[model samples]
Target: MELVFKTEDAISKLLTIKIEYFDSLQIYLLNDLWVHEMEGDFFLKEVESFKPILKRQLKYGLNPEEYINKVCKRIKEKLEFLEEHKVGSIEFLQFYCKQIKPITEITTFPSLGTDFYDEFKTSLKECKTDETDLYKFLVRFAEGNFNYTKYHEFSIGCLSYVIWNYYCALTELYRFVSTLQENAPFVDFSNLDIEDNKKCTEHLKTDIKVHFNQDKISVAHLFLFLLKEKHIVFDCKDERNNELQLKRFIEAHLTYLNINGDRVPIRSFNREFSEARASTKVQKHKQFINKFIYGLEQYRDSLKD
Candidate 1:
C-alpha cells in the first residue's frame, strides 16, 4: 500500500498530531485518577516527573473533575477532526505499517540483534522516501533519537531501538482495549453432546464416489464432462464462467474421489483440466466420449431394473 502522507511536511504534521493525542490521553488518565482519589505519593511523583502540572492537587489548584471533563471534550473534538480528515486510528496506522514489507522487519528481528541494524539499513534504503520519512517521524513522536549524518545515512541502530519501542506501545494499546470488554459473548456448551457432534462431523466428511477410469480418463476430463453435461451444477449466483466456478467449488468441497479411490487434489486437477480443455483432440476423441456415455447408460439401465 502507498504511504498515507505524500509530502515530508504532511508526515511531520501527522506525527505532531499523533504526539499531541498521546499527550492528551496521558493527561486525561492522570486527571481521572485524581478525581477518583486514587492518586498516591508514588503516582503523584511519577506524574510530576512526567508532566509536573498534572499533580494538580499539590502543585496546581485545579479541580481534577473539571480537568477530566475538559479533557473529554477536547478528545471528542480531536476524534471529530480525525474522522473528517481520515487520519485513521492507531490500529489503522499499525495495519498500514505492517503492509510495508520493510517495516515488518522491525517486529521479526533475529535473536542475535547484531545483523539486525545492517539488514534494516539495507531495507530502509530500498524503501520509498515517504515510507522512510513516516518511519522517522514516528520514531521522533515516540521519543526516539533520529540522528542523520551529512551523507544522508541515518542511525540504523537508533531506528531499530525506537521502532521496537513504538511497536510495543501499539501492542500495549491493543492489550489495554482488550481488557476493557469481552471480544465475544459467553456461551455455555454444557448441554451439547460430544458423540452427536462427532457423528455430524463424520457425516459431513463422507465423500461422494463416482465411476470413471483414472488411467484412461483423468479426473479433470471426468470433472469437465460432468460439468458440461450439467451433472454437477454449481449452486452459486456468481456471474463467473463455469470453469472458474467449478474450480472454486471443487477446491472448497474437497470431498470428491476419482474411480481409482484416490482424492482429487485441486492443483493437479487444475493443471489437467487446463491441458485437456485446450486440446481439441481430447474433446473430439470418440472412445473418450463414449466411455462417459456408456457409464451413464449403464447407471440408467441399473435404475430401471
Candidate 2:
C-alpha cells in the first residue's frame, strides 16, 4: 500500500515500535531503508517488479531465513557505517525521518492464497480485489512513494507476494528454522531499511537450494497448516522404505566422511541435514545430496594426502 523512507540513529533518537510481530518484518523495514538509500532505482524497481524474481527464488533457491539473515548482516554493516560516517548531517537524518509519513488511504480486502499456495491452493480459487486499481497503485506506490502506512500495507502484500513465488518454486513443503539456538545472531528489530530486509530475504533462500540438491522426498505439491510446516508424512509401507534407504545412505555417506577425516564438511552437512530433517513428515531429498557432495569432496581431499 505504501513505501516510506526514513531513518534514526544513535546521535538521533531511534524510532521505537512495539515488537509483538514477526522479527523478519522489522528486519525487512530496516533493510528497505538502506536499500532505497543506496540502490535507489534498482531497489524500487525490485519491489515494483517482484513477482518473477521472487517466484524464481521460491522455486529454485535457498531457504528464506538464511537469505534474510545475510541481508540483515549486510544491512547492519551499512547502517553502522552510515551512522558513524553521517554522509550528510544529523539534521539531515532527522529531517528525513520527519519528512516521511505512513500512507493508509488505499483500503482493500485480503487476497486469496489457496489458488497460489499449497495450503491455500484448494481453499480459494481466486483473489478478488476492488476495481479501484489497488494492485496497480500498489506497484506504482512501491516504486516511488513516501508513506509509512502505505509501505506497511505494501509489506503485508509482500508477504503474500513472497508466498506466491514460494508455491511456484517447489512441489513439496518445508521450513527454514527449527530448534533455534539459545543465542542466535541479532538482527534489525525495526522495519527501517527495505534493502537490508530484501537482501536478508534473498540470502535465506539458500536453504531451499540445499534441500533440492539433496532429493529424497520429491513430491511436487505440499501445504502448510501451521507456522512450522516441515512437509513430511509416512504410511506403513513408507516406514520400511525409509528405514532401509536411510540406513544405506547414512552408512555410505558417514563412512566416507569419517574415513576421509573430512570432519568439517561432514559436520556442516550434518547440521544442515538435521535442520532440514522432519520428525513426522518428509521433504526434499536434497538434504542427502548435499551430504553426499560433502562426503565426496572430503574423500577426494583424503585421496590427495
Candidate 3:
C-alpha cells in the first residue's frame, strides 16, 4: 500500500484501486454479504472504519485539497459516464444475479441433476494445488453443510495492516465474479483519457491473443467452481438461509497460496474472465471485471509477510 502511493503510477493506481474497491463493496451490498455467516454489525462497522483512515492517509501523502478533489471528481465523472451509457441500475443487476440462482440451487436438490455445470467442475479437478485439496474444498462448497475453518480471526487477520479494506473489497468482488452478471456493456470507453481508455479498450479487445496455459485455465476453473458452489447454497430455505461461507473459502485459499508461496492466479483468472465479460457487450459487467481485477491485483501484490 505504501509502495502504491510512492510509485510513479500512484494516481492511476489509486483510481484503479478506488474503483475496484467500490465494485467489491457494491457487490457486497448487492449480495447482502453480511447474511452469509458474517456478523452484520461487525462487518458494516469494519467497512465504515476504512474511509476515514484512507482519507487521512491520502491527505498526508497528497495535496490535501487538490488530490482529494481530483479523485472525487474523477470517480463521479466515471460513474456518470457509465450511467449515460445505460449501465443498469443496482436493482437491475441484483435482479440479474437472482435470475442465475437456480443453476446452483439445484445442487442441493434431493437428486443432483446430471448436467450440473460439469465443465466448471472439471476445471477445478485440472488445477491441482499442493497446499490444499481443491477437490475437497469444492465439495465442501457444493454441500455447504459443514462447520468450516474459521479464518477471519486467523489467516486473514494475519495479513498486513494495509489489507483490511482490500480484503473486504477483493473477497466481495470474487463473489460477484463467481455468480456473473447479465450480458450488457458495463462501461463507456470513449469518454476516458488516453491511458485509461487504452486500459479499458485492452480489456474489450479480442485482437491480441495469448497461448492458453493449462495451469492458468485450471486456476480459473477452481475459482469458477468455488463461485458456483457459493451460489448453490448462497440462499437456503431453512435455518441455513444465505449460508455464510465464501469469506472463509477465500481465506482458506489465500492461506494455502501464501504458505506455498504461490502467486494467486487471480490476476490471470480475472483477465480471462474480464475478456469474456467484455465480449458479452455488457458495459457494466466489463467495468466491474476491470476494476475489481485491478484492485485484486494490487491486493495480491501487497501480500508480503
Query: TM-score of each candidate?
Result: 0.27, 0.19, 0.21
TM-score of 1: 0.27
As a whole number from 0 to 100, the lDDT of residue 202 in candidate 2 is 25
Q: Write the per-residue lDDT of candidate 2 for residues 1-305, one digit (tens) a residue.
A: 01111111310122121111122332122222321122213323433343333233323444534644443343334333332332122222333454334433323323322222332212222433322222423342333332224334444334323322222121011121111110123332132223343343322332211122222221111111111242443224554333323322332233222323333111112212332444533434344445556988999988954
Candidate numbers, best lDDT first, in rank order: 1, 3, 2
Most accurate candidate by TM-score? 1
- Per-residue lDDT tens digits for candidate 3, residues 2-92, read 7335432433432232211112111122122221223323323443343343334333454333444454444434433332332222222
Checking candidate 1 for backbone clashes, the offending pairs are: none
Name the 10 consecutive residues with the lowest summed lDDT in model 2.
Answer: 173-182
Whole-model lDDT values for every prediction: 0.35, 0.29, 0.33
Among these predictions, the greatest lDDT belongs to 1
The predicted structure with the larger lDDT, 1 or 3, is: 1
Which of the predicted structures, 1 or 2, would earn the higher lDDT when compared with the native?
1
> Compared to the true structure, candidate 3 yields what TM-score?
0.21
